[model samples]
Target: MTAKAERMASLPSSLPPFGVGRLKAAALFDISPSLFDRLVESRQLPQPRLLGGRLVWDVSELGDAWRSLPHRLEDIDGFTTTGNPWDE
Candidate 1:
Protein backbone atom coordinates (compact mmCIF):
# COMPACT_ATOMS: atom_id res chain seq x y z
CA MET A 1 0.00 0.00 0.00
CA THR A 2 1.03 3.64 -0.58
CA ALA A 3 2.24 5.84 2.35
CA LYS A 4 -0.98 7.91 2.18
CA ALA A 5 -3.07 4.75 2.30
CA GLU A 6 -1.04 3.43 5.23
CA ARG A 7 -1.51 6.71 7.18
CA MET A 8 -5.22 6.74 6.48
CA ALA A 9 -5.54 3.17 7.68
CA SER A 10 -3.69 4.03 10.89
CA LEU A 11 -6.20 6.71 11.82
CA PRO A 12 -9.06 5.73 14.10
CA SER A 13 -12.55 5.62 12.68
CA SER A 14 -15.50 7.66 13.95
CA LEU A 15 -17.86 6.52 16.73
CA PRO A 16 -20.30 3.71 16.17
CA PRO A 17 -23.59 4.42 14.44
CA PHE A 18 -26.00 3.65 17.30
CA GLY A 19 -24.66 2.69 20.73
CA VAL A 20 -21.57 3.31 22.87
CA GLY A 21 -20.07 2.13 26.15
CA ARG A 22 -19.75 4.17 29.36
CA LEU A 23 -16.39 5.79 28.60
CA LYS A 24 -17.30 6.73 25.06
CA ALA A 25 -20.67 8.01 26.25
CA ALA A 26 -18.89 10.27 28.78
CA ALA A 27 -16.45 11.44 26.12
CA LEU A 28 -19.32 12.28 23.82
CA PHE A 29 -20.69 14.70 26.42
CA ASP A 30 -17.17 16.02 27.29
CA ILE A 31 -17.77 14.98 30.91
CA SER A 32 -16.12 12.49 33.27
CA PRO A 33 -17.51 9.00 33.69
CA SER A 34 -18.53 9.73 37.28
CA LEU A 35 -20.40 12.84 36.16
CA PHE A 36 -22.06 10.82 33.47
CA ASP A 37 -23.22 8.35 36.08
CA ARG A 38 -24.58 11.19 38.19
CA LEU A 39 -26.53 12.54 35.25
CA VAL A 40 -27.93 9.11 34.63
CA GLU A 41 -28.88 8.70 38.24
CA SER A 42 -30.57 12.10 38.30
CA ARG A 43 -32.49 11.22 35.11
CA GLN A 44 -30.85 14.02 33.22
CA LEU A 45 -29.64 11.40 30.79
CA PRO A 46 -31.15 8.19 29.57
CA GLN A 47 -30.14 4.86 31.03
CA PRO A 48 -28.22 2.37 28.94
CA ARG A 49 -29.71 -0.74 27.46
CA LEU A 50 -28.35 -4.16 28.24
CA LEU A 51 -26.84 -5.71 25.18
CA GLY A 52 -25.82 -9.28 25.97
CA GLY A 53 -24.96 -8.27 29.54
CA ARG A 54 -22.96 -5.19 28.43
CA LEU A 55 -24.38 -1.72 29.02
CA VAL A 56 -24.85 0.25 25.82
CA TRP A 57 -26.20 3.77 25.60
CA ASP A 58 -28.14 4.68 22.51
CA VAL A 59 -26.67 7.74 20.79
CA SER A 60 -30.07 8.98 19.67
CA GLU A 61 -31.48 8.69 23.19
CA LEU A 62 -28.49 10.48 24.65
CA GLY A 63 -28.87 13.28 22.12
CA ASP A 64 -32.54 13.63 22.95
CA ALA A 65 -31.86 13.79 26.67
CA TRP A 66 -29.11 16.35 26.18
CA ARG A 67 -31.35 18.57 24.11
CA SER A 68 -34.09 18.30 26.70
CA LEU A 69 -31.86 19.66 29.48
CA PRO A 70 -32.64 23.12 30.83
CA HIS A 71 -30.37 25.96 29.77
CA ARG A 72 -28.38 27.71 32.49
CA LEU A 73 -27.48 31.39 32.54
CA GLU A 74 -24.96 33.24 34.71
CA ASP A 75 -25.12 36.98 35.27
CA ILE A 76 -22.10 39.29 35.81
CA ASP A 77 -22.53 39.04 39.58
CA GLY A 78 -21.84 35.32 39.50
CA PHE A 79 -25.51 34.58 40.00
CA THR A 80 -26.93 31.61 38.14
CA THR A 81 -30.42 31.02 36.86
CA THR A 82 -32.20 27.74 36.16
CA GLY A 83 -35.49 26.82 34.44
CA ASN A 84 -37.05 29.09 31.84
CA PRO A 85 -35.66 32.63 32.09
CA TRP A 86 -38.63 33.97 30.13
CA ASP A 87 -41.00 32.69 32.83
CA GLU A 88 -39.55 35.12 35.36
Candidate 2:
Protein backbone atom coordinates (compact mmCIF):
# COMPACT_ATOMS: atom_id res chain seq x y z
CA MET A 1 0.00 0.00 0.00
CA THR A 2 1.18 3.48 -0.69
CA ALA A 3 1.90 5.89 2.20
CA LYS A 4 -1.41 7.71 1.77
CA ALA A 5 -3.37 4.44 1.57
CA GLU A 6 -1.59 3.09 4.66
CA ARG A 7 -2.32 6.28 6.56
CA MET A 8 -5.99 6.12 5.67
CA ALA A 9 -6.18 2.46 6.67
CA SER A 10 -4.71 3.26 10.11
CA LEU A 11 -7.37 5.89 10.77
CA PRO A 12 -10.81 5.06 12.13
CA SER A 13 -13.62 4.68 9.62
CA SER A 14 -15.75 7.79 9.59
CA LEU A 15 -19.28 6.82 8.65
CA PRO A 16 -21.78 9.60 8.24
CA PRO A 17 -25.37 9.19 9.41
CA PHE A 18 -26.62 8.71 5.88
CA GLY A 19 -24.39 5.68 5.34
CA VAL A 20 -25.01 3.97 8.71
CA GLY A 21 -27.67 1.36 9.24
CA ARG A 22 -29.30 0.08 12.45
CA LEU A 23 -27.90 -3.42 12.04
CA LYS A 24 -24.37 -2.11 11.60
CA ALA A 25 -24.65 -0.03 14.76
CA ALA A 26 -25.90 -3.01 16.77
CA ALA A 27 -23.13 -5.24 15.48
CA LEU A 28 -20.46 -2.73 16.38
CA PHE A 29 -21.80 -2.47 19.97
CA ASP A 30 -22.06 -6.24 20.36
CA ILE A 31 -25.75 -5.98 21.06
CA SER A 32 -29.05 -6.97 19.57
CA PRO A 33 -31.31 -4.89 17.33
CA SER A 34 -33.92 -4.94 20.09
CA LEU A 35 -31.53 -2.96 22.26
CA PHE A 36 -31.14 -0.41 19.51
CA ASP A 37 -34.89 -0.18 19.32
CA ARG A 38 -35.06 0.45 23.05
CA LEU A 39 -32.42 3.13 22.76
CA VAL A 40 -34.41 4.78 20.02
CA GLU A 41 -37.67 4.45 21.90
CA SER A 42 -36.14 5.97 25.00
CA ARG A 43 -34.50 8.73 22.98
CA GLN A 44 -31.13 7.61 24.28
CA LEU A 45 -29.82 7.02 20.79
CA PRO A 46 -29.24 9.63 18.17
CA GLN A 47 -32.26 10.58 16.13
CA PRO A 48 -32.20 8.77 12.86
CA ARG A 49 -32.68 10.96 9.86
CA LEU A 50 -35.05 9.85 7.16
CA LEU A 51 -33.09 9.47 3.96
CA GLY A 52 -34.79 7.68 1.08
CA GLY A 53 -36.90 5.78 3.65
CA ARG A 54 -33.80 4.52 5.51
CA LEU A 55 -33.01 5.33 9.14
CA VAL A 56 -29.45 6.28 9.97
CA TRP A 57 -27.38 7.56 12.88
CA ASP A 58 -24.52 10.04 12.95
CA VAL A 59 -21.22 8.24 13.58
CA SER A 60 -19.78 11.10 15.59
CA GLU A 61 -22.79 11.24 17.91
CA LEU A 62 -22.90 7.47 18.14
CA GLY A 63 -19.23 7.42 19.13
CA ASP A 64 -20.01 9.83 21.94
CA ALA A 65 -22.89 7.63 23.04
CA TRP A 66 -20.74 4.48 22.99
CA ARG A 67 -18.30 6.18 25.35
CA SER A 68 -21.15 7.38 27.57
CA LEU A 69 -22.48 3.83 27.96
CA PRO A 70 -19.38 2.81 29.93
CA HIS A 71 -19.66 5.91 32.04
CA ARG A 72 -23.34 5.44 32.89
CA LEU A 73 -22.89 2.13 34.67
CA GLU A 74 -26.22 0.97 36.03
CA ASP A 75 -26.98 -2.58 37.19
CA ILE A 76 -25.64 -4.88 34.53
CA ASP A 77 -24.10 -7.97 36.18
CA GLY A 78 -21.78 -8.62 33.27
CA PHE A 79 -20.19 -5.17 33.37
CA THR A 80 -17.55 -4.79 36.06
CA THR A 81 -15.86 -1.49 36.70
CA THR A 82 -14.95 0.92 39.52
CA GLY A 83 -18.21 2.84 38.89
CA ASN A 84 -16.31 5.90 37.85
CA PRO A 85 -12.79 5.65 36.45
CA TRP A 86 -12.20 9.26 37.50
CA ASP A 87 -13.52 8.69 41.05
CA GLU A 88 -10.13 7.81 42.43
Candidate 3:
Protein backbone atom coordinates (compact mmCIF):
# COMPACT_ATOMS: atom_id res chain seq x y z
CA MET A 1 0.00 0.00 0.00
CA THR A 2 1.05 3.63 -0.49
CA ALA A 3 2.17 5.74 2.46
CA LYS A 4 -1.00 7.75 2.39
CA ALA A 5 -3.09 4.59 2.42
CA GLU A 6 -1.14 3.37 5.42
CA ARG A 7 -1.75 6.66 7.20
CA MET A 8 -5.44 6.58 6.45
CA ALA A 9 -5.64 3.02 7.68
CA SER A 10 -4.10 4.10 10.96
CA LEU A 11 -7.07 6.27 11.87
CA PRO A 12 -9.41 4.82 14.45
CA SER A 13 -12.02 2.66 12.81
CA SER A 14 -14.37 3.27 15.70
CA LEU A 15 -15.10 6.76 14.45
CA PRO A 16 -17.91 7.46 12.04
CA PRO A 17 -17.13 6.69 8.42
CA PHE A 18 -18.14 10.24 7.49
CA GLY A 19 -14.67 11.01 8.79
CA VAL A 20 -12.96 13.45 11.17
CA GLY A 21 -12.92 17.05 12.32
CA ARG A 22 -10.94 19.79 10.51
CA LEU A 23 -7.91 19.47 12.76
CA LYS A 24 -7.75 15.72 12.39
CA ALA A 25 -8.23 15.97 8.65
CA ALA A 26 -5.31 18.39 8.37
CA ALA A 27 -3.09 16.03 10.29
CA LEU A 28 -4.17 13.15 8.12
CA PHE A 29 -3.18 15.14 5.04
CA ASP A 30 0.21 15.90 6.62
CA ILE A 31 -0.50 19.58 6.11
CA SER A 32 -0.79 22.50 8.47
CA PRO A 33 -4.23 23.81 9.31
CA SER A 34 -3.49 27.04 7.43
CA LEU A 35 -2.47 25.16 4.29
CA PHE A 36 -5.61 23.06 4.54
CA ASP A 37 -7.60 26.27 4.70
CA ARG A 38 -5.78 27.60 1.65
CA LEU A 39 -6.53 24.40 -0.26
CA VAL A 40 -10.20 24.71 0.63
CA GLU A 41 -10.25 28.34 -0.43
CA SER A 42 -8.68 27.40 -3.74
CA ARG A 43 -11.31 24.69 -4.17
CA GLN A 44 -8.57 22.12 -4.26
CA LEU A 45 -10.11 20.27 -1.36
CA PRO A 46 -13.57 18.86 -0.93
CA GLN A 47 -16.21 20.92 0.79
CA PRO A 48 -16.95 19.88 4.36
CA ARG A 49 -20.31 19.00 5.77
CA LEU A 50 -21.82 20.08 9.06
CA LEU A 51 -22.32 17.18 11.42
CA GLY A 52 -23.95 17.57 14.81
CA GLY A 53 -22.98 21.26 14.87
CA ARG A 54 -19.38 20.48 13.94
CA LEU A 55 -17.75 20.52 10.51
CA VAL A 56 -16.48 17.17 9.31
CA TRP A 57 -14.88 15.90 6.10
CA ASP A 58 -15.56 12.47 4.74
CA VAL A 59 -12.43 10.30 4.67
CA SER A 60 -13.25 8.75 1.33
CA GLU A 61 -13.95 12.12 -0.21
CA LEU A 62 -10.82 13.69 1.18
CA GLY A 63 -8.70 10.84 -0.07
CA ASP A 64 -10.21 11.09 -3.51
CA ALA A 65 -9.68 14.87 -3.62
CA TRP A 66 -6.10 14.64 -2.47
CA ARG A 67 -5.34 12.12 -5.18
CA SER A 68 -6.88 14.45 -7.75
CA LEU A 69 -4.86 17.58 -7.00
CA PRO A 70 -3.39 19.13 -10.16
CA HIS A 71 0.37 18.86 -10.61
CA ARG A 72 0.67 22.64 -11.08
CA LEU A 73 -1.12 23.36 -7.82
CA GLU A 74 2.17 23.27 -5.95
CA ASP A 75 3.90 25.53 -8.42
CA ILE A 76 1.27 28.21 -8.00
CA ASP A 77 1.84 28.30 -4.25
CA GLY A 78 5.10 30.20 -4.61
CA PHE A 79 3.61 32.72 -7.04
CA THR A 80 0.80 33.73 -4.76
CA THR A 81 2.01 36.91 -3.12
CA THR A 82 -0.98 37.39 -0.88
CA GLY A 83 -1.98 34.96 1.79
CA ASN A 84 -5.27 36.64 2.50
CA PRO A 85 -8.09 35.18 0.43
CA TRP A 86 -10.31 38.19 1.07
CA ASP A 87 -7.91 40.37 -0.91
CA GLU A 88 -8.35 38.26 -4.02
Please, what is the whole-model Cα lDDT of each candidate in the order they appear? 0.84, 0.73, 0.81
Candidate 2 clash pair list:
none
* Candidate 2 residue-wise lDDT at 84: 59
Worst 10 residues of 2 by lDDT: 70-79
6-62 per-residue lDDT for model 3 (tens digits): 987988978556677889889978999999989888888988888888888889999
User: After TM-score superposition, what is the CA distance of residue 32 in candidate 3 from its true location, in Å?
Assistant: 0.2
Please write out the lDDT profile of model 1 over residues 1-88, one tens digit for every residue: 9996896577677644588899989998999999999999998799999999999999999889777665656442445565648878
lDDT for model 2 comes to 0.73
Best by lDDT: 1
C-alpha lDDT of residue 58 in model 2? 69
- What shift in Å separates residue 18 of candidate 1 from its native position after superposition? 0.7
lDDT string for model 2 (1-81, tens) is 999689668867883333468998777677899998898789887777777888877677778778766445464567556
Q: Which residue runs of candidate 1 sit more than 4 Å off their true CA positions?
A: 1-16, 74-88
**Clash totals, every prediction:** 0, 0, 0
